[model samples]
Target: MTEPAWKSPTDARAEFRGGLRVPTAGWCAGWTQANLIAVPRALAYDMLLYAQRNPRPCPVLDVSDPGVVSTRLFGGDLRTDLPAYRIFERGELVGEVADARAVWRDDLVAFLIGCSFTFEAALAEAGVTLRHQEMGVNVPMYRTSLRTLPAGRLGGPLVVSMRPVPASLVATAVKVTARYPAVHGAPVHVGDPRTIGVTDLDAPDFGDPVEVRPGELPVFWACGVTPQAAVMESKPDFAIGHAPGHMGITDARDSEYLVP
Candidate 1:
C-alpha cells in the first residue's frame, strides 16, 4: 500500500494544524510518532513518576516546561498540531477537538510519550502485515486487567494496542520491534484476548477494531494511551491527551530510537 502524502513531520503537523484530522499511523512513515499528555504543573511530578515506574506503557520521550508547546523532538504547536485532542475535567472526557488552544492553560506541562507506531515502519519492512493500516482505521486499544505501578496520584490499568499478526510472521515482528525499546518494543501478550481481560476485541476502550484473520493471532503491545487511562481512573482535575489513535508526529527519526 502507498503511504500517506505527508512524508515529512513538518508537513504532517501543518496538515493537522490546518484541521486535517486522521489517525497518524501511516502518515510520516520513517518519522517517530508520540502520545501527548498535558497536565497542570502541580501534577507533572506525579505524572513523571508514574511514567518512570511504568516504563513499559509510558516510555517518555520529551517533556515540556509549563505551558510550553515546542520541544526538541517536536517543533509544532502542541495545542494545534495533532489531529485530535481530548480534554478532561476531573477525569471525565469533556471534549474532543481539532485544536486544543481554547482549553489549554498556562500552567500545563506536556509530555511526549513514546508510541509503538514508531517501530511499525521496521515491522512493515520486515514483511509483517499491518491490518489496521490496510483497513484504513485506527489501531484497536484496550484497557487490560494488568495494572500499572502507582506514583503519587497517578495509576490505572495498563492499556494495550492490538494487532493481528500472521502466526508465521509473529517472530519476525517481535524481533524487528524489540530493537526499539524506547517505543514500547515487542508484544506484551499474544493469542487469547481473554487472557488479558479483553473479552471482546470488536469493542475496544479506545480506537477502531480490525479483523483478526483465521491464521493470525491477536498481539498486544504496551500503549502510550495508558497515561490517558490513568488520567481517567485517577481523577486528575485537568488533562489533555491525543485522541486515542491520533498522535503527535515528531521531527525525530525512527532510527534515533533503534538499538544496534
Candidate 2:
C-alpha cells in the first residue's frame, strides 16, 4: 500500500491506523512524539510510580484513565496511533503488532511517555547535527549500568539513546535540550560509552547506530525505552509498548513541553 506523505500528527496516525509500521523519528516534525506503554490496571500503579521516580528516562506526558483510550491533553485514539507495538508476557516479547486493540481490556491503562525527538529539531537549529537522522536510521540506544530508582518491582538499568554531536556544538546541544524537561532533558553522559556500560557503539541493544566523526562526541540522553528494559527485568505478566523507534506523535507541539 502506498503511504501518504504525512505533515501532521493526524496524518501520521491515520497512516498507522492503516497498518503502516515506519520509524516515527522524522515524522510529524516538531510535534511531541510519545513512547507508548500499556499495562493492566493491576500493574499500572507500579508503572506510574516508576515513571514518577525516574522522570528523565520515563517522563509522564499523558496517562490514560483505566479503560479509557482518550487522554485529556490530546485528542486521539491510543489503540491505533503508533505505527508499531511490542507485546510482552512475563518479560518476554511475545509479538510485534501494528495495533494493540486486540489486547485492549476494560482495566488497561495507557501511558504516553515523552521522547527526546521533541528536542532534536531545536538542537539542529542551534547548530548541533543529528547523524542518525541524516543517515536515515533509527537513533542508537544502549542499556546502561545506571540503575533507575526501584518503584515496587519495576526497576532496572537505565537505557539511553546516543546521538553523535560535533564537539563545537556539544554545549549548544546540551543547553537546547535541557529546556525541555518533559522530554528526557540534557545529555546524561557526553563521552566514552564504556563509562556507561556500553561495550560497543555499533552494537546497540535497540535502534541503529550513527557515525561519530572526528571531533564529534557521543551524547547520551535518558531514553523512554528504559521502562521496557524494566519490564524485561521485572517480568510483568503483560505489557505493551512502542517498538523501538516507532513512537506516537501527539497533537501537542514540542514547544508545549519546553520549560521556562
Candidate 3:
C-alpha cells in the first residue's frame, strides 16, 4: 500500500511544495507541527524575550542559529518545510507564499514555537473529535482584546485557537491537554467568546471557523501564532511566519512535549 504523503516529515514538506496549501491539522498526526517565525537578527532578542514573557502562547521548541536553515530538532530546511508562509513587511501581511526560499536571509533567526496540534492529537486519542479536522478546515483562530506582556516592540493582542468540544467531554479535553503545558497546556477560556472579545465564532480573524454544534462548548487555547499577532502590532521592517493552521511538521513525537 502506498503510504500517505504526509506520514513522514520529509514527505509532508514535499506535499506542501507540491502545492498543497491547507490546514495541516490531522496530517502527520502524532508528530509535532510547529508555528514558524523568522525575523532579522536585530529583533531576535526582543522576540525571544517576548516568548519568555508570554510562554503560554509562545512556548519555545527550537530556535535556529542565525543563517541556519537546517533544524537541530528536526531534519528539514526551515525555508521549505512548512505548508505555507506569511510574510509581514512593516506590520502588515504583504503576501502568503508556499515556501520562503527566495526570501531566505543570512541574518534571519527562525524560531519553532510549540503548537496546540500536539495537544489536539492527544484530545483525539481521548475521543474528542476535532470538528475542524472532521470538516477538513483550519481550526478557527481569533485575535482577542487580551494583551500579551510586552517585550520591547514585540507585543500585541493575545491570539487563540478554538475547538468546539462535546459539553460532556470538555472536562476531559481540559484534563488531557493540561498535561502538555509546553504545548499550550489547557483551555484558557471556555464558553462565551465575548469574554475574550470574540464577537462571532462564525467569522474568525484567521483560519476557517467550524460549526459549534448544539451542546458543544467552544474551547479556546493560547496559540503559537500569538507572536505573529504581536508582530503585526510591532510591525518590524521584515518578518516571516507560518500561515495560521499551516505549520512546520517536525519529527519530534507529540509525547515529547508532555509534562508529568
Candidate 4:
C-alpha cells in the first residue's frame, strides 16, 4: 500500500481539480482552517472532556456521530472532504492517505478544533510580518513546561507556536490577536523562551524556527499541538489531527470568533 499524503484542506481542494488528485499546496485562502481528531464512540466522550479540560489548546468546534462522516457544522464532507487523513494506532503514525473511505468505521467520531491560521490574514492586514510565510516554512512550535488541566484521558505539557516580531510591533500583535479568542487569543509569553522551559530558540519541538533578529523578541502563543501532546501522553487507542500548519477552513469570518 502507498503511504498517504498529508495536505492542508485548501491544498487538497485545489488538487481535486481535474487531471490531478495529488497532494498540492496553496489551496483555499481566507477560510478558517481547523485541527481534526477522530476517535471511537467509546472514547468520544472522554475526548470531549479532554478538550473541555484544555480549552486553550483543544477548543471544540464540531463533532460527528459515532458512525457518520457528514459534518454540516463547518459545511464540509468528512470523507473525500479534505485533502488527506492520517492514521494513528496506539499513538504511532501508521500511514497517511488521500482518503479514509477504506477504513471508515461506524464507531468513529470526528472533532474539529480551531486553528491559529485563522488570524494570519488579520496579521498581514495589520502589517505584522509572519516570518514563517516569508521563509516558506512551517511555524515554530515548542513543548513548554506548563501543564494543562487534565481530564478523563488526556493531560500533558503545553505546546506553543513562536513568531519573531520586531520589538516595535509586539504590543500591537497582542491587541490584534486578543480580538480572536476562538483561534488561540493573545500571546502566552513574550521576550524570554527560558521562562517556558524552551532553552534553544533555534530548535523547536515542531515546525521550522524563523530568525530572531537583534531587535525582535520571540513571541509565543498556546498552540493546537498542546492537545496532540496531551493525547499522546493519554495513550488513547486512536486519534487523528492535521499535520501542523494544515487546517480545515470554515465559512465563518474572523470577527465572528472575537470576544467583545
Candidate 5:
C-alpha cells in the first residue's frame, strides 16, 4: 500500500495550530499501530482498571494525561497525528472524521491500546497471507459471549477480529503471535464459532468475512474491539476511536513490546 503524502512543514504546523489531521495507516509502514480512546480524566483510572482486568482484549500501549495532546510513549501528538477518529456521543457513533479538533477537551485523557496490527508485520514476515489485505476489505470481527471484568461504569462482552489461516500455517501463526502477550498474545479459540457463541461465520458483527478454503482454518483472536464493546454497552457520554485500517503509528517497533 502506498503511504499518504506528507504535508509540507508549514501546512502541518498550520494544521496543528488550527486542528489535528488524521494520517493514513499506510503512512507508517512497519511501525506498531494502535487503537485510541479518549475519556474524561475522572473516568481514566476506572477505564485503566478495566483494561487491567481484561488484558487479553484491552492490552494497553500507553496512557496520556488530561489536556495533554503529546503522547511521550509513542512520540505522537494526539491532536492531529492519527489517520482518523470516530466520535461517539452517548454511545452512538456521531461521526467519522479525520481528526478530533472540534470536540477536543481539556478534561480528556487519551488511552492507546494495542491492536492486532502490531503482529501483521510479523505475519507478513512469516509469509502468512492476510485475506483482508489481499481482498481490500476490513477484517471480520464479532461480539462474543465472553465477558470482561467490570470496572467503574465499564463492562461488556468481548469482541474479536478473525483471520483465516491455512491449516498448515495455523500452528506457526500461533507460535509467532504468542510472543506478544501484552498486545493480545495467543488465539483465544480456534476452528469453532459455536464455542465462542458465533452462530454464523458468514455474517460477522463487523468487517467482512473471508473464505476458508478446503485446507484452511478460521482462527480467531482477542481483538481490540473489547473497548468498543464496552463503549457500546456502558454508553459512555463521549468517546473517540481510530477509523478502521487507519491506526495511530508510533515510534515503538513491533519487537520491543513482545514478551520473548
Candidate 6:
C-alpha cells in the first residue's frame, strides 16, 4: 500500500479544509472516516428514526446539534473540513463544492455516519485486496432494488459499495469486516450484482467503477451514501452531504468501532 500523504485525522482535515478534494478511502490510515449529512432541524427526528430503522447502511457515529459545526467525533469545522460537499434542494442535487460554508444554515443538524473505509485497513491487514484503493479510484457504489424502511418523510433504496475480492479471500473479507458492525459490517451480498438489481457493474451510480479480475468476486457492502440517496428520493427541502466517495475523516480511532 502507498503511504498516505497525511498521518493523523487532524492533518487530513487540514488538507481538506485548505480546499483539497479527493476520495478519502486510504487517507488517514487507522482513523475512522465518516459520511456527512446535514438537514433542517425540523427533519432531524425523521433522519434519526430513519437511521434507527436502517442501521446497516446508516450507522450513526456522532450527531451535531442544530447549526453546530463540530462534534465530539469530529474536531474540525463541518462546513469546510470534508473534501467535498453536495448541496440539495427539494431533493435535487444543485451543487458540488469544495467548501459548504456559504450554503450552511444555522437550522441544520449534521449526522456523522460510520463509513466502510474505516475497515479497509483491517481488510488489507487480513490480506484482502481493495481494488479501488489499489487502482487509485473511488469505490464503486450502486443503488439497489432493496428499499429501506421509512421514517416520517425519509425513504429510499439502499445504496451499496462494491469491492472485487479474490474468490479465495472472500470469506476472510467477510470475517474481518463483520467485526466492525458500526461501519456497515459484512457483505450484504457476495456474488452476482444482478441479485441486488445491479445490472451493469461497469456503470455505477456513484464513484468510479473498478475492474473485477478473473479470479475475483464482486463483494458488496451497505454504503453510508444511502442517506444521500434518501435525500434525492425523499426530496427534503434542503440537505447537504459529502460527495459520494469523499468523506469526513474523524478523530475517533477505527479500533473504537471494532467488535470483539
lDDT of 3 by residue, 1-260 (tens): 33433487778877777777878888786788899989999999999999999999999999999978868776788887777899999999999998788877899999999999888778988999988888988899999989999999888999999999999999999999999988889888999999999999999999997999999999999999999998899999999999999998888888888887
Of 3 and 5, which scores higher on lDDT?
Answer: 3
Over 41-110, each residue of candidate 2 has an lDDT whose tens digit, in order, gives 9999999999999999999999999978878755778888788889999999999999889976788899
Q: What is the alpha-carbon lDDT of model 3 when measured against the actual structure?
A: 0.89
TM-score per candidate: 0.98, 0.96, 0.96, 0.85, 0.87, 0.98
Residue 81 CA error for candidate 4 (Å)? 3.8
Deviating ranges (above 4 Å) for candidate 6: 1-6
Off by over 4 Å in 3: 1-6
Give the per-residue Cα lDDT of candidate 4 at 54. 77
Model 4 segments more than 4 A misplaced: 1-27
lDDT for each residue of candidate 4 in 1-260, tens digit (9 for 90 to 100) = 22122334444444432123322122244556677778888888877897888787787877887777756555655655554666676777676655666766778888888777777667777888888877877788999998988877667899998988888999888998878887788989998999999999889987787899899999998888676777677778777665566555555555677688
For candidate 6, the 10 contiguous residues with the lowest summed lDDT are 1-10
**174-236 per-residue lDDT for model 6 (tens digits):** 999999999999989999999999999999999998999999999999999999999999999
Question: Ranking by TM-score, best first?
Answer: 6, 1, 3, 2, 5, 4
Using lDDT as the measure, which candidate wins? 6
Q: Is candidate 2 or candidate 4 better by lDDT?
A: 2
The per-residue C-alpha lDDT of model 1 at residue 98 equals: 100
* Global lDDT of each candidate: 0.93, 0.88, 0.89, 0.72, 0.76, 0.94
The residue pairs in collision within model 3 are none
lDDT of 6: 0.94
Better of 4 and 5 by TM-score: 5
Cα lDDT of model 5 by residue, 182-243, tens digit: 77888897898888998888898877777777888888889876787788789988888766
